[model samples]
Target: MSNVSYYTAEGLKKLKEELNQLRDVERPLASQAIAEARDKGDLSENAEYDAAKEAQGLLELKIAKLEETLANARLIDESQLDTSKVLVLSTVKLRNKQNGMEMKYTLVAESEADLKSGKISVTSPIGKGLLGKKVGDTASISVPNGTLKFEILEITRN
Candidate 1:
């Protein structure tokens, strides 16, 4: 069974763009490569043709995966999001209780997770730990290294 995927508006847009590129550009290019390889030599022992066919198969697989993701995606309503507690699409500011270090992160879908941009996957340990916690609440999360505690400082939609 295919699990339904929840995506922010931006994430859904990105998936649509990728699907367009695959259908219009990559698919045609793959077909052209296969045709060119087929013209090179006999099909029985043609190495180029075999390689091109393999590449085309991989391209089709990618296209299929993207299509499936798009079909299963549900856009999240950004306007309806509440900042009362940590939730998906919420930007949370936290202070480490053990080391007094401050950090901020936005909880997002797995596909939208980019640590460099401070977007964390909702399924991630830290994000999971912070979920449903209000300001002034302390969360104890288990990390790969060890257990760490964080105090929720603030929550915002942005």
Candidate 2:
């Protein structure tokens, strides 16, 4: 099962940076901790050794997962995208139908989604609803609260 994900250039760079940090900095630290713990006492009776071993295992698992994610990651070209409709990496400006409140969001990959940064995952309820919509198109999105309506004001590939 191969799960491919799309990301902007900046998002891909950030992912690579995190993977490098985990592999270069974190992996060595974990190994060092395990070695120091082993020098303390017998492995069977040493709680520090057990804890260190467990921590190393967890760190290795995280590194493996991150490696998998990076292996399947693809970088999207903003210039190649069509701004006529909402799509991955599309910065969409929306208007709330009821209140006329304007909001902007950048549709991104699941791992890159950050609400505080105005970036949303394409798999999210609002993102999914907004997908394939053109300017002035109304999207009825179902959320945890209920269905909410939004009008697509503009789509920019940035």
lDDT of the structure predicted as candidate 2: 0.93
Which candidate comes out best when scored by TM-score? 2
Residues 1-158, candidate 1, lDDT per residue (tens digit)?
A: 89788899889999899889988998899899889988987999999889889988998899899999988888888789888998899999999999999999999989999999999998999989999999999999999899999999999996
What's the true lDDT of residue 75 in model 2? 90
Q: Which segments of model 2 are wrong by more than 4 Å?
A: none
lDDT of 1 at 113: 98
Q: Can you write out model 2's per-residue Cα lDDT over 1-158, one digit (the tens) per residue?
A: 98999988888899999989999999999999999999997788999989989999999999899899999999997888998999999999999998999999999999889999999999999989999999999999988888899999999986
Please state the error at residue 72 of candidate 2 in Å: 0.6
Error of 2 at 133 (Å): 0.6
> In model 1, what lDDT does residue 21 have?
94
